[model samples]
Target: MERRLKISSGERLLDRALDEGIALEQECGGKLACASCRVVVLQGMHHLVAASEDEVDMLERAGASAPNARLACQVRGTGDIVIEIPDAELPPACAASSPVRVTPRAARHLAAQLNKHAGAVAVRLAVERSGCSGFSYRIDPAGAIGDGDAVFESHGVRIAVDAASLPYVQGTLLDLVREGLAHRLQIDNPNVRESCGCGKSFSARSS
Candidate 1:
């Protein structure tokens, strides 16, 4: 959808596009923390401001190092410019009723772990904004379902998640992965777009 617009001097590209009713994704509210607002400059690149070192590093980390790629939030246009907004719209979040599956092996493993903590009713699974990749999963033994918590049961084991964490983890599968002699618990999430190299954090495809 190519549309012509008159860009003013020092006008932020994101603001202008949004004002024109473009649904560009800015997951971090244009804070440069997420590269969801990346746009490919088709022409008039010279009219746009150069990207800062921070923005460059962030784009690199996000694997958006195209020659013409630019963060819509980071650049301002001084004149008419042609740019293409990629079809990188975030995936729609799953409904609250969507279930997070737990494999039988994971259920048994988690059950044993929960048994060690007396009175623990379920394992709380939540996501927090952390690490370079955007979010990290937090797990804790939940004693009770708190306010705005959604509870799910699988194989006699219950998993509790806060309302805020539900979208990022919906349709996720909890499994026990074995590699040679090593074994670890893994989260197979459908909403995750990319993960940190160390596997400690992930960036979700958010709407």
Candidate 2:
């Protein structure tokens, strides 16, 4: 479908779509964590904010190769733009099985950590393009749930993973490991094909 949207100085494209009753699948709640709301910008690319590294990563994960393809969830700025929403371009949803698993020990540790952080809702799990092996894992306490976050519970703690990161980290297990007197969390991802010798990152198998 074709639409011409004149956004305010800093209006998010996704919000405008919602206001106009347009159907855009924003599986990450406009968190820049998914590509479900991708649109091909036929005009006015210069008026929008430059895409961030995270958004680019998500687009790459979604296999969006077109130079003008932008995620509506992350497109916010001034001016008028013409965009095309391709019906068959939306990425598929995550698998039915839980993409990530947290062990009891890890859940206990995470739950305690969440208590320490102010207003922490769930533990956010994500993959960033970094380290020598192409990707690295990141875990942080999420203060609020995004609209498109894939939430799961293990033991008694909740975990949230953005839809974009779910594809690369599926079948992964989070656990706590103790070495000597120090304790650290570990990620056991079944999708890893190669690990950096420095133990800092890994390359995931194609989804």
Candidate 3:
């Protein structure tokens, strides 16, 4: 049976649903970390997947009060269902938003280049204060490691992040981009708020 998911205000319901063939809005490409893809299941709640610890934690952080609200990425169709879309969750600046994603090749290349220069490659990913929105990613060479940082390795590249930022970037994919004379790192973040026009800074939802 077909199921329906409703989007809330400022939410991109149809766009995201169509992108994944699930009839939901995923302005950030269905990244669970971003709340834009959130939905309110008006019916058939039993047919949806159970919420994970991560999802619950994020919802709490987002200050969502609706018991039925769920991230579309975390919900899979099981049977016929109904949902409602609200306008408050929709961002007025959706048109100007750019979602970032990372590629495996880029990660490997970055790791190799860093290793060549530093002998030991350390890529520190952190959220910094910048841009008009008040927050942006800060990628710099890690001169020393610190506590509360989670480390992950992919294709010889080491990724380090503090405990606080991990929840926001956990499922994120990283990639590099070159547009005209501009070369920059693109983050396929599901937890991003509207980024600055220059794409250097982002303001994520509270969750």
Candidate 4:
């Protein structure tokens, strides 16, 4: 089954959804920990299964609207559903523009942090074999610069991707978010398949 959801202004729902070819955001790969992929069910409420306690807890932290907001990771599609993106529920990292044409929110949040800290931090983007989707991201504060690495600067922060991983992450963006008491890094990648529920693994779709 398939579902359709609408994103508010400055949201990248369509881009991220099409890239993964799924109607869910498996942040933490889908671990149900980070609620970055939560969505509101504007229509077809009866089609979805009841929200589990864990999902409800996550939704509470996600600041989702009562009786409507649901985690995309948890709401398995039955036939089709219509969802509206809310700003209050919007992932913190979503923004309007990015240099790499990736998701803007994550990059914007990271940029804000860099500005506040005024410290040098390395952003390394890489893919690892793990998670429900068969792969996940490996993000770390870069320590050393390697030769022939592709680097892009956003909001005065330098993000580097290894030559090998560049293709997989091309046109991807990063964002930092604070949902309730939980804070996390979000990735909006154009090259990803279904991510595990744990947000630690993912699989790439075939060309």
The number of the candidate with the highest lDDT is 2
lDDT of 4 by residue, 1-207 (tens): 335654333334434355546545455876788887776676866666787866765664443435688776666545445775554645332222222332245556556654555344656677766656776677665765679677777545678778766666665656556789986776666567567767677676422
In candidate 3, stretches whose alpha carbon ends up further than 4 angstroms from where it belongs are 1-102, 181-183
Question: lDDT tens string, model 1, 36-131?
Answer: 888877788888889886676555434453688889999897888877876643222243345776766788889999999999999999999999
lDDT score, candidate 3:
0.61
Which candidate do you rate higher for lDDT, 1 or 3?
1
Backbone atom clashes (below 3 Å) for every candidate: 0, 3, 30, 28
TM-score of each: 0.53, 0.53, 0.47, 0.44
lDDT of 1 at 98: 50
lDDT at 99, model 4: 27
* Model 2 quality (TM-score): 0.53
Task: State the number of backbone clashes in model 4.
Answer: 28
- What C-alpha lDDT do the candidate models reach, one value each? 0.80, 0.81, 0.61, 0.59
What digit string (tens of lDDT, one per residue) describes model 2 on residues 19-42?
888899988787776688998899
lDDT of 4 at 54: 66
